[model samples]
Target: MKALRVEKPNNISVVEIPKVRLEKDNEILIKVKAAGICGSDISIYSGQSPVATYPRILGHEVTGIVEEISKSVTKFKVGDHVIIKQTESCNNCYACKHGRDNVCVDLKVRGVNIDGGYCEYITVPETSAYKIPKDLDFKTAVLIEPFTIAFQACSRGRLQKDDTLLVYGAGALGATVIQVAKSFGCKIIAVDIEEEKLIQAKNLGATYAINGKSPTLKEEIQAASENYGPTICIDSVCNPKSFEFLVDIVGNAGRVVLMGFDTRVSEIPQFKITARELDIIGSRLQHDKFEKVIDLFARDIIQPKDMISHVFHFEDIEKAFDVIASKQFRKIVLTF
Candidate 1:
């Protein structure tokens, strides 16, 4: 067996490792087929992620074929195609008991807290794996995890049909948000400083794509929303600037959902929140959205093929990291 290991911050290598087997009746062994490199993976590589542990395998957005299944695993078989949820929670926790396991007190994200699918083989609990249509390609299935994040964000926003949505970034996640919102019949306003990404957003069904660097960004958003301002604003950038701007762009009583990761303390405007009665919500990982995303893919409601701009062989894992660090592509996948 072989795996990509991050021995420490700023160090990663592909090394031969011992093969793993299903040791529990509730577990299934999968042969890794494709995995997506995420922004958090880049953070872990650069020593920027707080949750990442050293000497870890760095891949969570995974799609693989089942190589073996325990006798007790009746939900899956040896040849099934599946996507990994990555986030495994302790079902006994208060959050889990309330159907909020995504925020479980003892949440263990596969790639971050344990060995992930950055190798030839991996094993995961049957509960965390969802079967996908056998017709779906492995490269496309790899996107299910990231797409679920967007799905959960939109779910948190409680976006209504025909409502206007303002998205704070036009990167991969931002594009997903745009597509998901569009699927729900919401008019989308995508904001980003990169002109190319804004163009991509427009192609992804955003009604209006505003450059974050525009001198009249607020005015553009206002005009796009027909002067009432967007009813829902999702901050996928999660920086102080985007957070404050989200507060400013949303209409009165609008919902604001934060989906990006940032550790720095943000100075929020208490007055704006109090005066407008805005509903500020924080969305974590995907809840029960994987199946919906797969259905969306099947029905062509959200096409991810165009979003995947790059692919690399498993042996060129380091090169893939370099491309991700450079922000040269919308989505990058590693194929075994």
Candidate 2:
């Protein structure tokens, strides 16, 4: 068995390792076909975001086929194409009962709390395995986890039709936010430091895409919103400085959603948040909307393909991590 293991902070290797055994009756073994490196993965690769342990496999954006199913796993069978949820929620938790499972009290996240899919095979609980459409390619199936994050963000924001929205950072997650916002009929404003990402936002249906480095970003966002700026803004960059600009661009009583990973302590504009009556929300991973999000992709309603900018072979997992760290590409998928 070959797996990419992060032996320590800022260290990773793709080498032959002992195969994962299905010791639990409810778990199934999946032969990974493709996996995508997420922004969070970069944090784990570097020394920024700490993992649960050293020598862990750090990849959550996964798609694979079931190679073996435990006798207790009745929901899935061998040879079934599947997408694994990045996190597993205890169904008995209070949050899960109330439909907010992303914050389940006993949530266990793959790639962080447990081994993940940066390998030829992974063992996942039957509950986290979703049977994807047979026609869907491994690349697209691998995208469901990240896109589900975007979906959950929109769901938490309670987006409405015809409401103007702004998304900070045109990374893969940010691009997903743009597309979902557009589908709700809200005029989309996308902001990113990279020109290529901004261009991709427009190409994917954002009403307006602005480079955050542009000299007149404030003016551009204002102009795009017909003088009253966007009412709903999502800061996928998760920086205090970017949130400061977000506060400036949002209209009175607007909502701001924060979704990125920034470990450094930064000050928030608490005064502005209270004075402007803004709703500031922090979103995490996916909830119970996996089935719906996957259906959306299968129906061609949301094109995940547009966000996948680079594909790397399984052996070149290091290069894939490097590319993701470079921030020069949108979404990088590793095919086995």
Candidate 3:
């Protein structure tokens, strides 16, 4: 099998490796069809991700066909099209027992903490595999994982139909937030430094697009929300500066969800948070949202294809990473 491995910072290559086999009775062997490159993958390549280890196979957003299944795997069989839920939780943890497995104390995210799907074949536990719609192509199916992040963020922010949402960043996750917020009937204000991404956000149903670089960004957001600040703010940029703007642009009693992850710590405006009674929430990976996102895609509520700007082959892994680093596209997928 051919797997794309990151040996260290700024080092990645496609290397021939032994094929994976089912290690547990509850595991299934999948013939990877398509895998999406995430920002975390780029972080791993550049040695920025805190959790990622060296010589890791870097891919987590994946879709595949079940090539083989262990005898104990009755939920999935051969030829079943499935989407991988990269987060594997130890069901015994307090969080998992309380229905919050996404944040389990002993959680392991494939591609980040372990080997992932940037390969010809991969093996995962049956519990981590969900059957995708047969009609959905692999490229689009691969988006379910990322969409789940957006969905979880929106849910965490307690987005309401009557609320106005201010989303920072118009990258892939930000675009997903726009689409999800739109589905909930929330008016969206998409903010980004890139005009191209802002345009893409508008096309994805953002009611307003504001340049984060603008001198009066807070005023613009206030005006967009009819003289009141946004009722909810989502920070997808993960920058300290964006975090500051999130606190500044949200209305009194508004909810702010931090969806992006960075190691650097940012100062929190304690006075504003207390004076306005703001709710600051942190959203991590998906928590039981994959199936719902898949349904949304099936019903055309969220079109994954529109977000896909580039597709590369397994053999062109280096070129793919280069393009991802360029940040010119919304989403990039590697087809096996």
Candidate 4:
């Protein structure tokens, strides 16, 4: 099978390795159809992601067809179209036992800690495979994984319909957050450094788009959020100081969702936290959201095709990465 492997930092290629097979009775062999390249993939390629292991097959947001299934598999069968749930955890861990396996003590995400679905064929536990609507194209199905992140974020932030929501970063992940927030009937303020991206965010259901580079950014956000500051803020930008900036703007008793893996220390004042009774949450991969996201796509409740900026053949992955340097794409997918 052909697997797109990052040989080392700044070195990736289409390499032929021994094909994967169903190593466990609960596993199913997937013929990968489409995979979305996440920012983490670029991080791994450039040797920036702290958790990424090199010589790795780089894809986690994936959609595929079940080519074969183990005898023990009952959740799916041969020829089932599925979107993968890429999280891995030890069920015996404390977090897992508490039904929070998304933060399992020994969590390992495919394509980072292990090889992922950026190949001609891959095999995974049937537990990781959720069947997609037969009519949903592979390219659009791949967006479901990103939407799972959006769902998890909203869940963590306790998003409510009447609350004002402010989202930072109008890129791929932020776009999903805006769309999901729309489903909750919340007023959304989309923030980004790019004008075009902000425009796209509005098209995707953002109530207002504010350029982060604007000198009146705070005032603008205050206006859009009804002069009381937002009740919930999701920061997809993940900059070192994002914590402080968000804390200064969110209303009292509000929640701030942090999605980045940045390691820098933030100087958020303890007084501000206590006075506002703020909730600072860190949202990771996803927790039990694949099924909900699938339903959203399957029912045509959310437009997934609009999320795609470009599609490239699996072999032209280098070209796709080049597009990332332009800083203009939403979701870039690789077709197998």
Please, what is the TM-score per model? 0.96, 0.89, 0.93, 0.95
Model 2 TM-score, all chains together: 0.89
Task: Compute the lDDT of residue 282 as modeled in candidate 4.
Answer: 92
After TM-score superposition, what is the CA distance of residue 62 in candidate 1 from its true location, in Å? 0.7
Write the number of the candidate with greater lDDT, choosing between 1 and 4: 4
lDDT of each: 0.89, 0.83, 0.89, 0.90
Instruction: Summarize candidate 3's per-residue lDDT along 229-290 as a digit string, tens digits.
Output: 99999998887877887887789999989976666778885998999999999999988898
Error of 3 at 134 (Å): 1.6
- Comparing 1 with 3 on TM-score, the higher-scoring candidate is 1
- 2 or 3, which is superior by TM-score? 3
**What is candidate 4's lDDT per residue for 145-224, written digit by digit as tens?**
98999999998999999999999998877988998888889999999998988988999999999999999999999998
Candidate 3: segments with Cα more than 4 A from true spot: 325-327
RMSD of each: 1.5, 2.5, 1.8, 1.6
Candidate with top TM-score is: 1
Give per-residue CA lDDT, model 1, range 1-336, as digits (tens): 999888999888998999998899999999999999888888887888988888899899999999999879988998999998878888998999998899999998877988788999989989989999999999988888888999999999998897899989988789888888888998899999999899889999999998888898889889999999999999988887778878888899899999867777777869989898899999989799999999998888888887788899988987887787787677889998
lDDT for position 200 in model 3: 86
The list of candidate 4 runs beyond 4 A from truth reads 326-328
Give the number of the best model, judged by lDDT: 4
